[model samples]
Each structure stands twice: as structure tokens, then as C-alpha cells.
Target: MQAFSEILDQWKTQQPEDNRDDYYKIFTAVKDFDKHIARRYDGLRNSWFLGTVTALLAEKIITTSDLEDFSEEAKSKIARALKFREQYEL
Candidate 1:
């Protein structure tokens, strides 16, 4: 499977602002669905769902900085993402 970062990278290049906005919306919806599924199912692990969310967030902020021009919004997102990177540790 293609990595989440690669998928987000492609979407970033498209620069579909409206779609990008909706992407977050749809992601949240799907995540909620997955959370429900996990709760309803016996074998589902919370980490599985959370890992996907974390991966998507990391992809948006780690794979590109095209939003850097926006304002502190972009900066904060980038900063939050970078925390996952080892370089930020020390």
C-alpha cells in the first residue's frame, strides 16, 4: 500500500483548497466510523485507528510545507508534526 505521506503529497500538489478543506472533514468522519467499529467489534484495537490518524496528520505536516505562507496556522501545524521527527528531540 502507498504510504499516507505519499497520498497526502499528491493531494498537496493538486492544491484543491476546497477539497483539502473537505479532506479533513471526511477524514474525521471516517475516523469516527472506525472508532465506532472498534467499539462494536471484539478484536479492534484503539491503536490501529489512532495510528492511521497520526499517520495522516504526520503526512500533511511532515511531507510538505506548501501551507507555510498561510500564517501561524501553518507554522503551528508544522511544529506539531515536526515533534514526531527524531531531529526535533535534541
Candidate 2:
């Protein structure tokens, strides 16, 4: 993703002199990111679509307007999921 790439790219300019520290930082960042990517993006099934969209909305990676193309029922489901997340998960 563009955001992920930008975050990785930033390491090039951060503490370049400390090779050991930089290696550890980059290693940890990439390992954490890899885990997230595996959990979120890998093996994406249709059943996960609505929940994933709701999460993306909560994370502000996507806008509410993006749901305009989906059916009203789907949009409603996502709205409810978001409401539940906001009220309970926070």
C-alpha cells in the first residue's frame, strides 16, 4: 500500500549512521506490518468483505461515500457494524 511504502521509505532518512539500530527498527517494522497484512489482506473471502469495509471505514482508509456503489442492504450492514464498533469497541 502507498501508506505502508511511505512508512518503510522513511527509514532511509532516519538514523542512517546506526546500522545496528536501523536494522532492528526496520526488521521489527516489517515483521509487524507483515503480520497485519497476513491477517487483513490474505485469503480474503466474500464473507469478510462487509467486516473489512467496516474496519477500513473505522480506520479512515475509506470514506463513507465509497459505499455508494454497494446495495443499500450492504451499506446498512456496514453502518450498523461501524456503530457497534464505535459504541462498544472503543
Candidate 3:
């Protein structure tokens, strides 16, 4: 995780002209990391993995409703993903 943060910081410093897009790209990378780890630990069918991600997103939204600078379409995708997560007994 610290290594990922360092990479993110390096990318942001190198591309200072577009911080928002870079931040979103970092968020996606982190999310993909979570998904990869989850699959390694619990396989692809685990709802707990999705629930954990949904919970993280919800927590972030509580702190900052920016949704990682997501556009309306991306926000809709997040909404649907979270909705799918909510159906499980996490």
C-alpha cells in the first residue's frame, strides 16, 4: 500500500497539470488492487469483497462527496455496483 501511494505521488508530481484525473486513476488502481487481493483470498464469488468495497466508498462519500471526481455516468456505475453489494448479507 505504501508503495502504491508512492507511485501515485510520483505520478501526480510528474503530471501536475491534471491532478483530478490522476487522482481518479489512482482510485481505480486502488480499487483494482482490492479486487485482486479479494480474488486471491476469497475467489470471485464472494459478496464480502464487494461489500467491503461498497463500505469503503460509502465511508469516503461521508467524508467527501466528490466520488473521486466521477462524472455522472461513473457515479451511476458506482451506484449500481453498491446496489449489487447491498443485496448480500455482509
lDDT: which candidate is best?
A: 2
Name the weakest run of 10 consecutive residues (lDDT summed) in model 3.
Answer: 44-53
Task: Tell me the TM-score of each prediction against the true structure.
Answer: 0.28, 0.76, 0.35
lDDT of 3: 0.66
Which digits, one per residue and each the tens of the lDDT, describe model 1 over residues 1-90?
234455577677876757866577557667876786566465647645434433445556334444445467555654565576536542
C-alpha lDDT (0 to 100) for residue 24 of candidate 3: 78
Say which prediction, candidate 2 or candidate 3, comes out ahead on TM-score.
Answer: 2
Tens digits of per-residue lDDT for model 3 on 2-38? 7578878788679787688777777888999898777
User: What are the Cα lDDT values of the candidates?
Assistant: 0.56, 0.84, 0.66
Query: Which pairs clash (backbone N, Cα, C closer than 3 Å) in model 1?
Result: none
lDDT of 2: 0.84
Clashes of 2: 0
